[model samples]
Target: MLIGYARVSTLEQREDLQVDALKAAGCDRWYVDHASGAKASRPELDRMFEVLRPGDVVVVWKLDRLGRSVQHLVDVMVRLQGMGVGFRSLTEQMDTTTPGGVLVFNVFAAMAQFERDLIRERTNAGLKAARARGRVGGRRRKLGSSDEAMIRQLYDSGSVTVQEIAGRFGVSRGTIYRTIARTSKG
Candidate 1:
């Protein structure tokens, strides 16, 4: 049996075209997910998976209808293959039941991976250059040096509790404790 899957990113969008394609491809029944491609989980997709059998073939209007990313698509393909289930993407004209289809899918996956690697490499290089110029990442400290000194004084005077100091500085009690601990260390 060929089980079809369709997807649209929002409630406002329709899966009419996908449904038509699935039907034309001779799908026995179909599932539709009204969710973003970025989401890792979708109710209809999960439900469809529950009913898949060894000899079943999963059909989709397009590969993107089935997964959020290339990695996700590959993972789904692997799972389907393990279950002896075939995959057919009408738009891509690829079928995991055939050798050429599998080769093309693997090539696409490789390109996606290479693109991700290049993005990561460029980001790392940019960060390295910024660090060389004495620029740093992450949030700035909530408490300045003067504020730390004041917190330490207030903590040592025993006039205020750590909670009271935290309230005064608009920070957490942990920050107050750390400020006092820094005084001991210095």
Candidate 2:
């Protein structure tokens, strides 16, 4: 079964072009969504997925109409392939049910993975350089060295409850406990 999916960015925009293309391409049934490509929620798209069978092919007027980005497209393709379903982009003339389309989709998946790996490598390198310069990556310390003395004094006196000390210090009881432990260690 050939199932079509068409989308327009807004409710005001008509899906005439995509709808016509899908019909001409011999789509058995179609779904349309008045939602932005970047949106994760598309009710009609979700419905289409529920009705899809093993041999059903999902057809879109263009590749962009189906995904927010190349990576997103690759992810959707991977999911479809896993379900034993195929994908077709009319504008791109790509059909995953065909040999050439399979080759092209594989290349796309590879490229997306390569791009993600490169991004991860660059981020790691940047963090390493920052660490070498004595910069840290985590959240800033809530308590300073100067506060340790007063915290210890209050804790040793045992007049203030741990919860009260935490409230005064604007931190969690865990922070108060850690503070007392560190001071005791010193």
Candidate 3:
């Protein structure tokens, strides 16, 4: 059985093109997901996996329709293989059932991993450089020095409770405690 999977980034986008292609490729059943590929939870995709049986070939109009990233695609392929199922991408002309197709897919997966590693290395290097330049990366402080001083004075004077101060400043009690800790540290 050739089971098809079609996807679109949003509900507004049409899956007609992908569905038509899958039909042309002789898919007997279909699973359609109308959500962003970046989303981790895809109900339709999950359902498709549940219905997959041994000797079934999972077909997609394009490789991207099946996975958001190379690692994800490779993982899915490995899972299908483990279950004695096959994978095919119409646009990429890939069929895991064949030796040459398997070789090409492995090469592509390796390249994708390499690319991801390069990106991670570059990002870490860039972040380190920025830190060296005294450019710390994180959210900006919500409370200022004066606010901290006032909080301390109110707490020390015993005129206001922690919850009262937090409510006045529209911040959580944890934020107030953190502010005190930060002020004490400095």
Candidate 4:
């Protein structure tokens, strides 16, 4: 079974070209979506996946119609391959059912992984440098010295509950407890 998927970035855009190409490629079933590729949710795409069975090949008019980026394309291809389904892009002449297509897809998958690794390494290095400069990556501290002192005083007075302190400071009760723990440890 050759399933077709056609998409347009906006409602104003027409999917006629893609649909025609997919039909020409001998697609037995069709799924269409009119949404941005950047969006993660696509009801038609999800439905297509649900209807896909082993040995079914998913055909798209173009590679970009199926994924937002190379990484995303690789991920979707890998998932389809794992499920014993194949993929074909009419414009790109990519057919994962062929040996040559498998080789090309493997290279693409490797490149995507390499790109992700490079990004991860750079991010880690940046965070390390920031930490060396006495800067940390996270939300800004919501409580100041005065707030901490007031919270401590309130807790010690035995007249205020943890929830009350948290409400007054606009933080969670767990945060108040952790603050008290840190102060006691210091």
Candidate 5:
């Protein structure tokens, strides 16, 4: 049996294209989910994996729809293979049932991981260069050190609640709470 999986990032997005394509590809049953590719907890995907059996084929519109991380995709594919289930991605034209397809997928996965590593390297280099030039990182603090000290003192005195301190300082309660937490931890 061929089972299809379709996903969109948000509930507002439509799954029409993926659904139509999966149906056209002769999917016997399909599951759809409105979940982000970066998110690990996808109920539909979990259910599909649970129900998959030997001789079953799992299909998706694209490799990205199944997972964002190459390691994650490889792990999922390995699990499916262990269960004697075939996996296919329509857009990438990858099918794990065939030797050639498995090779192609492995190459693609390597490239994806390499690309991410390159991006991280470049980002770190840029940050290091910026730091050497005396360029400070991150958002400029909305509240200065003096303001933060005052907020902390108010909280320590137990005279003002976090919300009250935040209101007085014109900051969010989270900001006030985080400031207090940071000081306490340090």
Candidate 6:
């Protein structure tokens, strides 16, 4: 049995073309997921994989429909292979049932892994450069030690309302409340 998988990023998008293509390609069953490819949890795809069996061919109209990243696609392919399921991508002309197709998939998988490594290396280098330039990353603390101590003192003495402290400290009421709660916890 050939199981077809179709995907669209948004609910507004149509799945007609993918469904027609998959049916035309001789798919016996079909699954459709209307969600972002970047998301790891795809409910429809999970269900399809769980129900797939030996001699089952998982078909997609295009390679992108299978995954957002090449690494992700290869991981899914490996999982399918381990389950004795075959894979077919119409646009990429890939069929995991054949030796040639297996070779092609392996090569693509290796390249994808290499690309990920390069991205990680580049990101690390960029961060190092930024640090050398004295650029601190992430958010700054809302309240300094002196302000925090005063806030705690005021709260402990019950001298001021949370809204009054927030207005005086130039912060939100929630921030004032949280600070009081945190100081109380300590």
Question: In terms of TM-score, which candidate is strongest?
Answer: 4
Name every residue pair that clashes in candidate 6: none
Q: How many backbone clashes does candidate 1 have?
A: 0
**lDDT score for residue 95 of model 6:** 96
lDDT of each: 0.90, 0.93, 0.91, 0.92, 0.89, 0.92
Candidate 6 residue-wise lDDT, 1-186, digit = tens:
999999999999999999999999999889999999998779999999889999899999999998888899999999998999999999889999999999998998899889999999999999899999998887886998789889989877788888888989999999887777766754
Give candidate 5 regions above 4 Å deviation: 6-26, 32-46, 61-84, 90-92, 152-158, 172-186
Higher-ranked by TM-score: 2 or 4: 4
Evaluate model 6: give its TM-score: 0.74
Q: TM-score for all predictions?
A: 0.82, 0.82, 0.79, 0.92, 0.65, 0.74
Per-residue lDDT of 185 in model 5: 43
After superposition, the stretches of candidate 3 with alpha carbons farther than 4 Å from their true spots are: 9-17, 156-159, 184-186
RMSD of each: 2.6, 2.7, 2.9, 1.7, 4.8, 4.4
Model 4: runs farther than 4 Å from truth?
Answer: none
CA displacement after TM-score superposition, residue 50 of candidate 2 (Å) = 1.1
Displacement of residue 54 (Cα, Å) in model 1 is 3.2
How far is 15's C-alpha from truth in model 3 (Å)? 3.8
> How much is the lDDT of residue 121 in candidate 1?
100
Q: 1-186, model 1: which lDDT tens digit per residue?
A: 999999999999999999999999999999999999998889999999999999999999988888888889988888898899999999889998899988987897787789889999999999999999999998899999999888878877899899989998899998788778887645
Q: What is the lDDT of candidate 2?
A: 0.93
Ten-residue region with minimum lDDT total, candidate 1 = 177-186
Colliding pairs, model 2: none
Error of 5 at 127 (Å): 0.6
Q: If both were scored by lDDT, which would come out higher, candidate 3 or candidate 5? A: 3
Q: State in Å the error of residue 179, model 5.
A: 5.2
Q: After superposition, how far is residue 10 of candidate 6 from its true place, in Å?
A: 3.8
Q: How accurate is candidate 6 locally (lDDT)?
A: 0.92
* TM accuracy, model 5: 0.65
